[model samples]
Target: MEEGATETPEELLAKQHRKEKKDLQAKIQSLKNAVPKNDKKRRKQLTEDIAKLEAELNQKHEEELKQLKSPADTKVGEMINGVEAMTVEGGDQQEVKQPRVTKAQKRRDKKAAQEKERESRIAEAEVQNLLGERHQEGLKLAQKLAQRQLQIREISSDGHCMYRAVEDQLVQRAVPGLTLVLKELRSRTAEYMRNHADDFVPFLTNPNTGDMYTADEFEKYCSDVEHTAAWGGQLELRALTHVLQLPIEVIQADSPTIKIGEEYDSEPITLVYMLHAYGLGEHYNSVERLKDPANEEDS
Candidate 1:
């Protein structure tokens, strides 16, 4: 045998199975010797381990038998000859060698791949359902504005979706190096709310408890919003609008009229209003970008 020669896939797998079986046997013996007979819990755990190891050993044995019954076309010794047989242009008949993979391994890999694809499809369908009419309306609007098709680019629906959505839009508009902008904006919004408590305190009510927020509760709420990954809401949005000093328009499918900021005079940054339902309650959904067909070609 050549020094440091790579083993055939079958040889490697067989070696691994033998090593595992030996290790498991050693573990079982050690556990039996060390564990006391009176210790029922330890005995039970050891018994479970032995059973699991036995099951694995049986599976490996079955695989070995199956492999032996139908021997692989390429073996470790044959691989060397196969490589040597390969010649330059117009030489002796050359055979292409492929790695040997067991039927069980192939089936397992195939099943895993299919499962991943299925999960991806389901996630995409859920996003589409969440967008619903808003997605359709956005597409129509895109056609009217630029005579082009639009595609939705989904953002993460985590608590910071609103800030993240705005950040994404800014990035799309060719803004450079603003990774921490969202965090900064969040801090600024919290500070603004604290400074102007009179304007925001009356509107601060806990959605879950349906009770007006006390000074301490509202303070803690602002702290959570600023420092933690707590979900942003209308209050945060208003603060963000003021801090950014830019008018924002929320376009909703249910409403014909667009919701602009308090000032509503400056050039507006537009965003779609996604709707989602959880049990009996409804909430704002994560935003998706309408990709322009013209921009697609450029990119």
Candidate 2:
């Protein structure tokens, strides 16, 4: 009758069964005590009542146990079984299966892959074009400026260098290369003297014998010559300036307002053309002269 003091049907049933069992047990004990004092009828009634209560209790317990072990409780086990079936042979067969791509998606992927390959090819071609133009231009300029042709040689396993017509020119230009050459020559000389005194000094005396040392030794002596030729950089800077027909400072310095004819000042289209020509060793800042016949007469 108290508020919120309600027992559910299952709770009430359990409570009733407990009370009945307790009462039957008490009655049976009393009957046993009386049986020793000649109360036969009371003992028989109590025994019947106890047996009936016990039967009811057994039936109720069996029903409760059945409810506890019902089909709903086996759902987790069923789910596990299903998963094992899928992995081994059942639960999520579709999930275990490979995903299928749509025809439209496949087409799109193919198109994208093709586009990427095409762009890669175009980029490679552009770099090759630049290198080809530069090689040709260097060859032309070597003849014009050095009066000696330039030969592009792979002097190492992977490195490249432009030699002035002949390998001996490396020795002539060795004075201008760099401190790297100086340090290396000194190091090699020291190492050589330590290892073979007679062979090294005599080797140093012979200009060709210097070449007997590895490319690494020869490189340091050559670096200073190249550096001096550009004043501070390399012949490339000189070559670039000469090719662009611009002053050394214009190319070397950073400027906000680009001069049209100078390396930094040209229009975007002109810059591209100059880049191409500069690589080719024929840097021209303007295509305007080509467009204008009158400009040719003025030239």
Most accurate candidate by TM-score: 1
Residue pairs clashing in model 1 are none
Residue lDDT tens for model 2, 1-299: 36523444345446655785686576556435433222233335546755765675566555444443543332222332334223233323343432355665456446545754764575465346435755344333323322222112212111112211112222433434422332333333334334443333233332665445454553443443333221112223233333333332211111221223245452221111112333333232211111222442354
In model 2, which regions exceed 4 Å deviation? 1-124, 127-136, 142-150, 153-181, 184-299
Count of backbone clashes, every candidate in sequence: 0, 20
lDDT of 2 at 102: 60
Range of the 10 consecutive residues with the lowest summed lDDT in candidate 1? 277-286
TM-scores of all predicted structures: 0.45, 0.19
Cα deviation at 135, candidate 2, in Å, is: 4.9
Tens digit of lDDT per residue, candidate 1, span 1-299? Answer: 37534565456556666886787677568657654343344457668856865775676456444544454523333432345443446555576566677886577546545754764575465346435654355444434333222233345666676677666655655534434367886898899999988878889788899888889998998898799877776677778778766676654545653554658465555554556422212233323344443554355
Q: lDDT of all the models against the reference?
A: 0.59, 0.36
Off by over 4 Å in 1: 1-151, 173-180, 207-209, 262-265, 277-299
